[model samples]
Target: MKTVILVALLLLLFPIPVLGGESGLVISSYSVNPSTLFPGDTGKLVVTVTNTGTRSAEIREAVLYGNGLKVLSPGYSKLGTLTSGGSVDLTFVISGMKEGVYYPTLVVRGNDSTLQYPILVTVDSTEPEVLLDTGILYVNEVNRINFTIINPRSGDLTSIKVRPIVDGNVYPEYLYFDRISGGSSAKGVFYLYTTKPVETVQFSLQFNNGENVRYTNTTAPINSLPSREIQISLEKYPNEVLRYDTVVFSGNITNLRQDTIYSLIMSIEGDGIVSSRDVVLPALSSMDSVPFTIRVTPISSGTKHLTLTYMYSDVLGKIYTGSTDLYIQVPDKDVLSLNGVEIKKDGIELNIIGDVSNLGNYEVKGVTVSVLASDSEESYFIGALAPSDFNSFDINIPVKENTSTITISIQFVTGVGQLITIQQNLPVKEKPVLKEPEIPKKYYILIGLISVLVLVVVGYSWKRAMQ
Candidate 1:
């Protein structure tokens, strides 16, 4: 006592490519929800009715009409039976008043059998797209913007977020994405810095399609352009620093851009610095310059403060950093002077040779040359002396006896590293006095025959002292 099958939804100008006749109940699958629709959007048009053969099928009512797709879900007096191979599903709420494709139909009348089906609905308005993947954009430095998040519309799109408005200055207000699979595209990065002039750079796009909720507003235009400089040059550092000297800071690192530059790095920091060496470059072409050296030894003296940091990348990789500054003048350990001291004597020992010149312009490391006789002390090691360069040391020492003078020390190490020693006082040479051997002419003829026999015995004693 329950049988009502009056389903209809005809509107297919030239549809019917597959309609069932023997009535085993057909109309297998059909769907159209948020698949697409935007003129008045509000969708749902599902239909699935299958009975096949060998059986029970008695659907009483189901109706849906179509024009621009307006069927507002009404008829359904009694959509009840469908057993044998069984299946039944019919819903229709669709409302998208015009924009494009629409072909709805789904008739199902049992017993006399008449199951026709056809479903396809789409009413797009198309949105979602934001361009500008960086080519040039800079006014007051720092600008590597890139935004391209397109989902032109076909279906998938949800949660995806993007925000960047650079008049108030933005660097990453928000940029999230969980899904974006319609036509597809994704990439967003920002790091803007504008001090005065700015024309455009705003992009705000929100998403979600199935439940309907979307927004899009994009703008990418700015032609102020004037920010490109990465040419550090320290002039080979060395102005004048003698006291406790040990300062070096070399230069050259120009890569003025024409593209090609990635992962370049350079470092040097100071504040009483005593060691350093860092420089790596993975790539760098176009304008290339490279060459940097730093060797310090400052326990913080006077006006010293150094810094030279750097980072690079460009060619879609983005990142680009900078830093440069150095000021030096450490005066306090230079008063050493005792050039070319020489003292050679070899037997009682006492050599003390010389030559340890650097004359100041830079380079001077551990130049030694000691000597202190008697209580004994000898040394010589002059290493790394280059500026006018000169190295030579001899030291021997070993000649005592109240040891006159002879100190001679002379240690050096200045370049900001101070360790100087200078002493001088030499004198210790006196040992030569012995002259007695100048009477050899046969002893001068035997002293002249003993003076003529003492004058013949004094002339006979003067003739007998007068008788």
Candidate 2:
């Protein structure tokens, strides 16, 4: 009984040795040397890893990886063995060149399980500014834009670029610089093309501080010229002329203000007129008159109302419009008229004659003359007639014994799809019939006496033969 008690006590004193599951490792604490940092700044990151299981853990090394942060110091460190509940500290020196929140991952291998630790770091901000030397923008010319990049943080800024966002187009979209030290500034130039007028323009600034990529956007007001500073005058050729005449128009654009103008264009528009050209001027100086001409031919005769429009830009590239009106008079024109008609008889056919005259400003086409009798019609084509000209035509038709009247038709077509017909009635007078000459009376009485004598001789010869 004493031996049993002694064994029990000994067994209780010394525990039995048994193999169990693998060891586990975890991150105990983590810290960044400088908790707060700005772009283009350098700082240290420290991480403490501990073995939390009952057994010892053999770790190969600790590795770190993250975006927006460049590792300046060694990223890997050898951690051979970690006893139960023991802790090890690992460090990395990293630099940030862009502004944002960054999460770094730490990996440790060679133990029963792979251990990963995630760390968060925040980077401060910096920005730049842009200004236009001129108050407003103008069309058809290049405008200079100025940019100034300032470093507000304690670190250096690099890869600084300022870009202008315009509604139309801009030359050299961006201005770039290599570096700008902290608390200092750098200058750049950007050429912009403001094809149209706008109220404001946006400028975007992109740059990299040692620790982060930074961005900023700003807007500025654009001053544009108004139409009140422009003067326009219109002059026309041959103030009083006939229809279809070529009207030459001259327009003068004068800049009343001291500011210079660009892209001066004049356009003329009206009804019943055709123009072959538009006037454009490259540049107009201050207080100067730019003259431009346009030729237009009027189609119809009447009062023609013409509108002249002028568009131009100021020194800053904004567009403005102005207009002027002019009135013209075109005289009326008479196109065609029927002169006269005549009819005569020739053998068994009747001849119808008529004359047509063209009195209009334009040529008349497809003119034809036809004689319409009671039964049928006979036509003679006259083809085309020039202005202020006349032509005579005759059509012959066979008529029955007593036809006394006939009608005439003159049909013509204008080039613009207008058909005109003229009609006239002519009286026909028949020629007098001729009478045969009467035979003489004495010749008829002599023939009667000869016939009686021949009859008396025949009777006497018959009576003598019978006796």
Candidate 3:
């Protein structure tokens, strides 16, 4: 009777093993569904435990642990008894897991044995979005754009990278992000400006989850208004004049812009002329005539072209150019003439003689004659010549011992303010005489007498000594 009871107990305790002692309790369907989950997102973990042992076993408990992760449901599963071939299923809800790889532990306890199972889970908390304030912008205008980041998972985000692609070029330096905390949301602003008419800009965003997003836009047309045009006009008074006549040319500049201009500059370009002073003109203003004088000599009797150029900067810093031309006719070469230049021992003087039939078309102002010595260190200024129908100036230059050559620079200033200068060179020659000193004939006669007296005395003394 005891043997019969023992056999029945053993049979009940050791029901048919699933593998007949081939393997112990094993996990058949042990996995977490949707292995990847973002921050603040929920995921399901399903584990299937099976008893492959040779004897019946009881499963006591199972637990799961991970950094910054929580289980929403009971992680433990109790199996009262497991037949030779029996399996149990356990499902757990996990939430609030940080962004990273996570490992959870699954423990199963039997009446005589304990088993451990490790499961891997990944939580992603990355939200990368690129936003701009305006799609179009004007040239030379400031534009601002804003960017925001979003994290879907409840896990804390660590680092973020942003890149701006402008004009087909990638610019990593233009990116801005937050570094204080690893929050799922961040905000930033971007300011941009351009000088060109049209441009295109692009930007990209990357998150810790290895996800990338790109955005692009075309800029609007940049308008540049036309600047004001400014110009200088030159006019000569009594355009035509006789030789040795003075001519006056006046300059004036007008600002055509609606805004004011500053630093007006005026210059003259031509042959046989002078330039007026530079005048500053106000906005939308006209400058009065500025006068410049030129003296014409008989030598400069011909047609000449005079050009006056003016430049100024407007209020907007735009430069403008302006210019004008004038035609001047000098008297015929015969009507205006220089008679003759003469040099003397006491001083040098230039004689200028000219006739103005009609004063021509221009008035004769004055004349200036200058005398320059070839050997002189400096040229002497003979004041202005007397202006009349017949003009003449006597330039007296003091003669010096070393005066060898003299140059007379004859300049005629006309009544109309025209200048003409002529130059002439003259040579001065002088020879020096030296006299030879005379020697007296009496000195030679005295020396010969003294020699004869010495010879007679010597002969007489020799004869006396011999006797």
Candidate 4:
């Protein structure tokens, strides 16, 4: 008895182990469509049965039974034989009648054994999400609104479609997407034309849970902005321009509206004699200002017409253009003139002296005068002559006896830094010819004869007066 008791205790402590073969027709993987369900909504439950054993297994029936989650399809029967390491799919249609959580049992019966597995199913009646974003919409033009449909379930959604519900104008009334994985999101887009003070925009999304069709909607407010005029003024510009006056038309371009300006450009086209180049400022934000300058050079004198043109576009793809006209009168007067000119001949040289005056309204820099005589050339420098100002210049150039005309050139730099030279021909003065004191050729004898005659007449008149 003691030996049997010891053997029993020993056997209880360390029992003998029995090893068997691997399992066949196991429930390898299972999934419920739209893993979360809604009341009265139908879905699917797919179970993958694999033959992981050394030999094939014959599947007799694959069925599902539960109290809360209702099964609409009958059991899968006579599924044939599954080869070793091969697999087959078992699908069942299921639904929920009320909002609650349910545990359903999957019973797989094979020729060798029977197995039962419980799957947790949910029926919370939670709806999917539809998000709408109207990103930077402009008034009275084509705009885009984005829609993001999110699936909060554990299974994927199918045949998803979104519709933009707007009472106003829009294109392609609806947008379609094929599918959205469970717990993931999908995107959709719609183009709409909106006006200022836009109305509320709404959206509706419809999809399938592999069994029944479901819907989700949203009512989002649509926002839009209007275009305000850009402020432009000629802040620092000359009202009149000289023949070669390079005047800068500087102004401040301000964005008074609530949107950024795009591709802003200012131009002064080549209008006959008035010419300029283009100035550009790509973008300007709201309430921001940018200063610009355009250099103008006029080549001719007239009632010249110029325009300071500006152009830009908005986010709505509409181009806005404006112009500020400028009228400048260029007088037909010589820029430099000579005053108080005097010429004299001294021996074999000619002296030329004058005051060089700037007649235009602009200053002339680096002024000089040159004289070309018959036998020689001369030059004088009179630097930096302001408008209506004068400077003296004198030149002594060698000349021949027969020299009659001489050339005078006035050279200077314009206010805009241009070298200019003007030439004029002047007649040289000749020396006065003098004869040795006029010999009274018989003139002295005739004067003595006149004096004798006057004396005789005076003697006769005196004798008569004495008598």
lDDT of every model, 2 decimals: 0.69, 0.69, 0.52, 0.75
Best by lDDT: 4
TM for candidate 2 is 0.37
lDDT of 4 at 377: 81
296-344 in candidate 1: lDDT tens per residue?
Answer: 6555447777777888866555677888777777665443345676776
Q: Ranking by lDDT, best first?
A: 4, 1, 2, 3
Report the lDDT tens digits of candidate 2 across residue range 113-133.
Answer: 666555666676544555555
How much RMSD separates candidate 1 from the native structure? 16.2
Model 1 per-residue lDDT at 432: 50
* Model 4 worst lDDT run, 10 consecutive residues: 12-21
| lDDT per residue as tens, model 4, 188-256 | 777775555565677787888766788877777656676456888776566666665556677888987
Which of the numbered candidates is closest to the native, going by highest TM-score?
4
Local accuracy of candidate 3 as per-residue lDDT tens digits, 327-423: 7787564233445434445434322222222234344333444556544423333344433344444555555667777665655444434455655
The TM-score that candidate 4 achieves is 0.56
Q: Could you tell me the lDDT of residue 189 within candidate 1?
A: 82
TM-score of each: 0.38, 0.37, 0.30, 0.56
Question: Any runs in candidate 1 off by more than 4 Å, and if so which?
Answer: 1-31, 38-45, 48-122, 131-219, 222-225, 228-238, 241-293, 296-336, 339-365, 370-467
- Show where candidate 2 strays beyond 4 Å: 1-199, 205-211, 218-334, 345-349, 399-407, 417-467
